[model samples]
Target: MCRTTLTLGLTGLALLHAGPAATWLPVVRRRLPGLAGAGDADHVALTFDDGPDPRSTPRFLAELDRLGCRATFFVVGETLARHPDLGRRTVAEGHEVAVHGWRHRNALLTRPGRVTGEIARAADLVAAVTGAEPVWYRPPYGVLSAETLTAARRRGLRPVLWTTWGRDWTRSADPDSVLATLAPGLRGGATVLLHDCDHTSAPGAWRSALGALPGLVARCRELGLRVGPLAEHGVS
Candidate 1:
């Protein structure tokens, strides 16, 4: 019995010295923001940002309609104010509208007062158009800071980051590449980041990424993944 205890103690020490198996903890958390209804099944959430663009948004909405899916739109304060009709349509279509900052400024670099103004102004705009304050905020470029988190929390908005990004902001990111990048995390409970306004890309180049949506949805379904609103997963 003494020998057995010694061996067992040595084994415990060895395990401690070996450190954690990196693979055991996935590089990315399976779900972020800890939404309410997340489950093991393959489920995905779609979101669009930097939008309320008159031309692109309508097209994007039509595409979602074709797939019989709803998405969340992270609207810029300035843009939403410029195109209130587009914002209204997003709500009318049963999509959730969230704030994406006022000027699309990088929240990480912004001052606390500026951050507060940015988020609050955007929330006000979203609430005016949608009849409710936004519950989610996605910092421009997925950049987050202590100030950003604090400001967001104060406004009752949860900071949501994407689990996978398609790099749709790049003009050269064709539909195939976007689909490929997201293929791995397409399983479920994924928050995918795509852009409706790609100023960096060729003029109107986001069309290609938009073109890929239907097929992407089909592929996810084939893999037994269900696509739905983030709120359905208790994200809001």
Candidate 2:
């Protein structure tokens, strides 16, 4: 009986970790409304997570610059400490900079108080450096819990998740594959998730996302979809 109960409990917990499960989980869906798609009409929000990498980030910045597009970079606090300049450049370049967390931690595995602290510190650090308070927060790996959700709301931060992601964190991913994954989700009013660094991903996986971005931007223009930060999605 003990083993059966444990097994069932684990199964439910695993289900909650699923990114797609946000649709079925009311507690998450209510507090995290951006997961399914755009909050506004006519534009799609482009957001990158786990970044501020000096190596890979500059290239992404350049590409967006060339295309006259802007994205939100949800930076990890720990990495930001190591590369404050990259974080600053993100802000300088017209992209929105938001907090991912103090570290890339799973909220479900962390205590509620600790989860709050993680976001608080990250938000403070980001604001201190950028002179702008991040209005949005995205948990690491897109995983969330009731504790994290409440903590985010308490800090005056809105929790957001993506409607479409390129799965650019894997070594197996490339520009074509990334574009393929994003194609189906490419529609007006979608939140697109990609990565700018590989600090927590396969080495050099960030390149896949970087390579696919121009095409993504072009396609958006072709479809008459404007690509910009979450602010355009009315996240703030």
The local distance difference test score of model 1 is 0.70
lDDT of 2 at 104: 86
Determine which window of 10 residues in candidate 2 has minimal summed lDDT.
1-10
Put down candidate 1 lDDT per residue, 38-80, tens digits, no spaces. Answer: 3335678888888978878899999899889998889899989
Off by over 4 Å in 1: 1-40, 200-202
Cα lDDT of all candidates, in order? Answer: 0.70, 0.79
Residue range 1-236, candidate 2, lDDT tens digits: 22332232234455433233333334333444554435666788999998888889999999999989998999999899888888888898899999899988666677658988889889988998888899888877566566666777788888777778888878899999999999998888778889998887789999999999889999999998899999877642
The most accurate candidate by lDDT is 2
